[model samples]
Target: MANWNLKSFDDIYSSIAESAYKDRPNSFPKLFNKNKSTEIDYSKSKKDNEGQITKGGGTDLPNGGKVYLQPDSKKLLEDEETGYNAYYVTDTETINANTHQTYFAIRGSDGFGINLPQIKKGNFKEFNYQDWINNDAAFALTDAIVPQAKYATKGMKEKITELEEKAAPNAKMDVTAHSLGTMVSVQGLAGLSESELNHVGKAVLFDGPDTTASLKKAGYSDEKLKLLDKKLFIMSILLIQLVCSIVINHGINN
Candidate 1:
């Protein structure tokens, strides 16, 4: 038979009992210095403590504690020349929440950051058959215009108009996008009038599919194709190197 130590159990119980006693209410009267003012003397006496009376419960003055003051709002405007305008327009779901679209008009200098503007209902009016070609429709009237694969809905053209209006009206603006965003950005920019194009500094596209055949057909240079092929070759080499490095690292870890 195995024997358990009774002495060990007694020690454990004693330690727990000591801990509980220490955590219990204070057993002695709190001490005070004669020279220092007591909180009781400073406070207004409310009720007499059993008649003969204690002066008061405590001082009305708060104990020294931390009070945090809010930091001042910094100015948003940046001071710079030759800077481009930028906008981070929220998608439609958010636009529906406030019953208006939030248009952020940002430029390199002054008047920077997000601005929420309520676009009235029916802001995007439907175009008549003539409006599609001759009127002030956002997109072109051409029958052969290819629908960009990235933009699945017709509502995208409305969004483009909103972005254009909300951007810095006087400053140069450039549209940029990643993946599906590139498709819409390019189409929107292409539809702009010649005057609007002058204000546009540059457009950046990332991982985007082919543009409409007409857009390319206007001018597809051999030099551009060679540059694209060179980039693809470099990318292939880098990908292979990355795979080899990953395999080597996995073997080392094992």
Candidate 2:
């Protein structure tokens, strides 16, 4: 988004409108190769305990909780990112499970990271279409802009409650959310009773927006939620990376 200056925006718009617009040969896709992976040194071997990173660079989520996921989930995990204006959103789906608890991860939207220069601060609405945007934060947060956040929250709450009921009595959930995923988690959880929220054990948010107002409006207060214990944030503009992949596995084990 650093290249989102007035001239660059005009260039991209022209590139889309005019096929012959070649003065600037670079298209939006060319300028930002979203497929490019972030560089970081990683251990090639698996660490001990409930989780593992397969040799293929995929995450091996932990199981042994009360919920359920695919049979092969322990052997394979993939991170899917959006290319264009696309979004990977869902109501609810199990990441992995066991007899005592479950583990679920929520992915954020497909837009620029929190570091988007245009958004000096505040939610996406403050920067762009705020008038008619409404509660579209939940969907737009996940890059699913056509649907609004209220509907998404409803569907998600239903899914979470369903999972909670299906699992063993007092079954717990360990949540990991990234970007818009954090909003989804908070909104969905806010709809649940305090007892239900207690079933949620731990949460790890990766660059997710602070949805305090969003949750409070939905009837979830800090006094109501009480789920922020053991919470950690990563890659946030104002916070440090207190939670890492190891913390994700550890959260599940606890």
| Strongest candidate by lDDT | 2
Candidate 2 per-residue C-alpha lDDT over 138-181 given as tens digits, one digit per residue, 9 for 90 to 100: 34454333223343344334435645656555555555544455
Q: Write the per-residue lDDT of candidate 1 for residues 1-254, one digit (tens) a residue.
A: 00111111111111111111111111001211223311212123322222322122133222111111111122111111212212322222222322122222221111122232422443332322221222112223332223331221222334344445553343333333333333334444555445444454445443344545434553435544333322221112233335545655787899
Q: What is the C-alpha local distance difference test score of candidate 1?
A: 0.28
- Give the lDDT of residue 227 in candidate 2: 59
Please list the C-alpha lDDT of all candidates, in the order they appear.
0.28, 0.36
* TM-score for each model: 0.25, 0.41
Q: Estimate the TM-score for candidate 2.
A: 0.41
Name the 10 consecutive residues with the lowest summed lDDT in model 1: 1-10
